[model samples]
Target: MLPGLFRNASRMYDCTSRVLQHYEALYRLVGIPEKEMMHSIMKNSKFELFLMKVVQQKVVTGLIPLLNHISKSNIEVDLQEVFKRFTFDNSCLMVLGFDPISLSVEFPKRTYEKAFDEIEEAILYRHIVPKWCWKLQRWLQIGQEKKLRKAWDAFDRFLNQRIASKREQLLSREKTHLEEAKFDLLTAYMMQEEIVNMGVCSKSNKILRDTAFNLIAAGSDTMGAGLARFFWLIATHPSVEMKILKEIKENLMVKDDKKEVGVFRTAVKADTLPSGHHISANTPIIISLYAMGRMEEIWGEDCIQYKPERWISEQGGLISVPSYKFTAFGGGPRSCLGKAMAFIQMKIVATSIIWNFHFEMVEGHPVSPSVSVVLHMKHGLKVRITKRSV
Candidate 1:
């Protein structure tokens, strides 16, 4: 029903032209041929510093005040909403060089933000209902189909406006100092287009719009939901929370620290299964990462338990599990491009919040996964916040 970024012909599923487009626009941001350019961009000192500054600014100006208000009012706050706003603001700033300030203390309602949630929910509806049923709704423009249409339009307008603005700025601005300035992803795309004279696919504004939308969509909501789940798990397991806190305290004192899927696949050629099951060519397969993670064979008897130590080595360092085994950020060639960026953002936000506040889940509040494309909390995570004295 909805085919903006995730389902578009030029999206991740296409293994040919779309993949090349992604490599040119996203992986080779600066017109460089480095295989790891995207990861390098995230790790660059300047980029890391820029991220730190943005996170600190948001926490000081946005999050702290909101938490203070919630504490003073003694009311339960839906942490899911808060994280969504926070990550949305950050993603906008990082991707488009614009700050919507959606994460303010006032907690204002934003139509554009609401559009994202609507789009995700509608996509999930499309999966559950019969394809013909949704097709009929799309034909008639009724129900969830109607909402998806509006949401798609909203995304188009918002992204088109930003792309136009960035193009104009690049045209009017002098080229001498462009190399010295830090460029957002949109800026980088425009610059790369100028240098490489990208192919017809990347030359069009549609590609840019789709790329921007995909990055922002992937960055904001997924990160927000993941953080909410992390906090929820920590709050429910006191030992884990305390260990995190203790690690933070010790690291601060030492002054040194380091720190999905409606997924499917289609077979191109005839192949034999490793488990002795054979399939013909052009077979479509659905892989469930959730089920894989819970399998006793893969994760042992305690796979269902929430144990952070599973990822820790005997030497106290992180154990590297193959991407195919973990499969959260995806595996193999089409793995997530934003993995490094996501980790940096999560660490900055998680550490700041964990150190500065203590979260207690509201008693008797229900917590379960939402029935959507994104793994959002169904009823939202309701919690009481208290300021922590460091």
Candidate 2:
């Protein structure tokens, strides 16, 4: 879906390409510092910073601030919980142009959390059950199909209302104040290929909706799940946890190290790294996200070990990680837009939790994948956190 969305139209988007090229097209645009806008639909560059500022300013501006608000309130919960809901809400706004405010603690709602989980469960069912069986069941409203139908209704009603509202706004006689409003793919589709214009939008609103929802649905959990697992690995493995802490201390000041949850600095140089601290160089992430955790290349002989030093170079920064070596976020034309966002957020969250708290697993707790498009832990991440003074 991501490859189809972006690959064919890349040549046509030469103008946007040239602009990003001017900033250094490394995709991993290195040692260069600049403002970065993370969007899942970045696959096409249609939503590049230029297009997004023009098309999605309201929604984009709303997201990080909303994340900030969520961060402030969810101190008791895991960072994944807050960031996942924040990204989910933001992705919905980017595609659908509204917020469900799932991150709001006191809101009158079951929260978007359950809705996200239900969609995850239903998707899993599709994988395990025969397609015909599931289809028939969906039609008949029996068993999990009935549950799935309810989710479909929840999703459809939400989408239909939002789509209808946007259509009304577009059809009104007054000119579209697109600059002031959220510039989402929905609006992009509406304007670009109207029945009179090119026939893309007018021929199929449902397809457009599906495209937008595809972006929303695919992005939400992959990032959140990766961070959750990364931290869980850190918390569970004392040696690896110690290494990451030492790495952090190498680059950070005593005061900086002491800061509470979410004290994030840019990826900066440590004044020095000890000589023995060698990292595997220029490797891409393993393509299978799970395969990454098990790869000897990614984590050395102790492939299953949770070693942050494996990601560190004796020379500091990342060890010249190539795009394809590790599939932590897929590879090639289908690479994740949320990669940088997840890394930055993970470092912040991991740093805070590890620095400020000591966590221990509850014995015999079940941790299995939630069986979604992305790998999320089912039954939640169960652990105990106690404040750490040092």
Candidate 3:
């Protein structure tokens, strides 16, 4: 049975037959086949220009102000929360053509943000409980299922409001000739609908809503959690951190340096595996990327250790690993479309933070992985920040 969170819609996580066809149509407008579309988008001048502008604005207006406040206060801060806010703002701006300004020195609480967390927790709950149990709860409108329903409503309201505002803005821009140079994901999708006559605009709204929800959901927390783990790892491994700093300084003349743990997919048809295992159609498969990353066969004896050198060659270039072996971002046709965008954002944030501040973990603070859809810190990454002399 499908989880309440997804329902019957063909979202990014859904494996319905129409999902591929929809993605293919969208991919065509961007001038690339489905398989190669993401890579091409990363290289597209318009997209790159848009991303750069958004990142720069966020760094200056959101990240720097907050970091400065934390540094001046000299109090321990949860780096995870900070990262989450930063990514959330960026995701909204890139996907919806608007910024909620969630990342700030004030650390304001956002209803939609909390709703996303609740939705995710409920999704995980559905996975652990028996299918019938969750379905019963869903039908009765109680427990995690109730919370999921509420969160879903809040999420839908948030998106619908934004979509309406965007439509109005587009119409105004057409008459006024005040159009932006870059189109956000939502704007692009809406334009595609109009140009291609995919369906009635009203019916297409649900598809647009789902697409926006999926992109923001996929981009925000995953990047936030990954960066949180990255910083914690670097903080604990001083030697690796120093090496990164050295590389950043020597190579860039200033500055500094820098998943979903599993991939879940449903088999579309009955197939026999290369490893001789057989599964029926619609069998769900979960590839443990966390386990894969730690395997000695995949990453050598030092696989368990956090070593920056593992990814570097003797010639000081990045070592190339096939996507199948290094499956952090998944492998094959359904690999993450945001992989390149994620790296670019990570580099910008990491370099800025490392170059400007030094982080120290709070004494006696415990750092461990949380049990959730995304591998976040059980206890958030608490640390104090000091401004760097440079």
Q: Which prediction has the highest lDDT against the true structure?
A: 3
TM-scores for the candidates: 0.83, 0.60, 0.85
lDDT of candidate 2 over 1-390, digit per residue (tens): 111111111111101111122223333433222112223234345454433332233223443344344444433344446546655665665566666666544433452446546766775676567789999988888888788677766776666677777777777723554543435656655655463365433525555445555556645555456556665665666776676576567655546555543000122333322445433443221123455446676556886643445555576545545544554444565355545443443444455556655656566777775545455666666665555556
Worst 10 residues of 3 by lDDT: 1-10
Clashing pairs in 3: none
Model 1 deviation from native, Cα RMSD in Å: 7.6
Candidate 3 lDDT, 51-92, residue by residue in tens: 877887798778877888999998999999999999999999
Model 3: how far is 326 from its true place, Å? 0.9
Candidate 1's residue-wise lDDT over 1-390, tens digit each? 011111111111111122233444654553444344345555567776776677677777887788878888888999989998999988887778788898876788777778877877787687679889999999999999999999989978888898787766677775643443355666765665565665321446776776677668767877787778777876887777677778766665634332100455667898987777788898866566657767899889997777777766677767677877776677787677766676767776767777777899999999987666556778999999987754
Question: Which regions of candidate 3 are displaced past 4 Å?
Answer: 1-43, 174-178, 198-203, 254-261, 269-278
Model 2: lDDT to the true structure = 0.50
lDDT scores of the candidates, listed in order: 0.69, 0.50, 0.70
TM-score for candidate 2: 0.60
Steric clash count of candidate 1: 0
* Displacement of the residue 6 alpha carbon in candidate 2, Å: 24
Q: After superposition, how far is residue 100 of candidate 2 from its true place, in Å?
A: 1.1
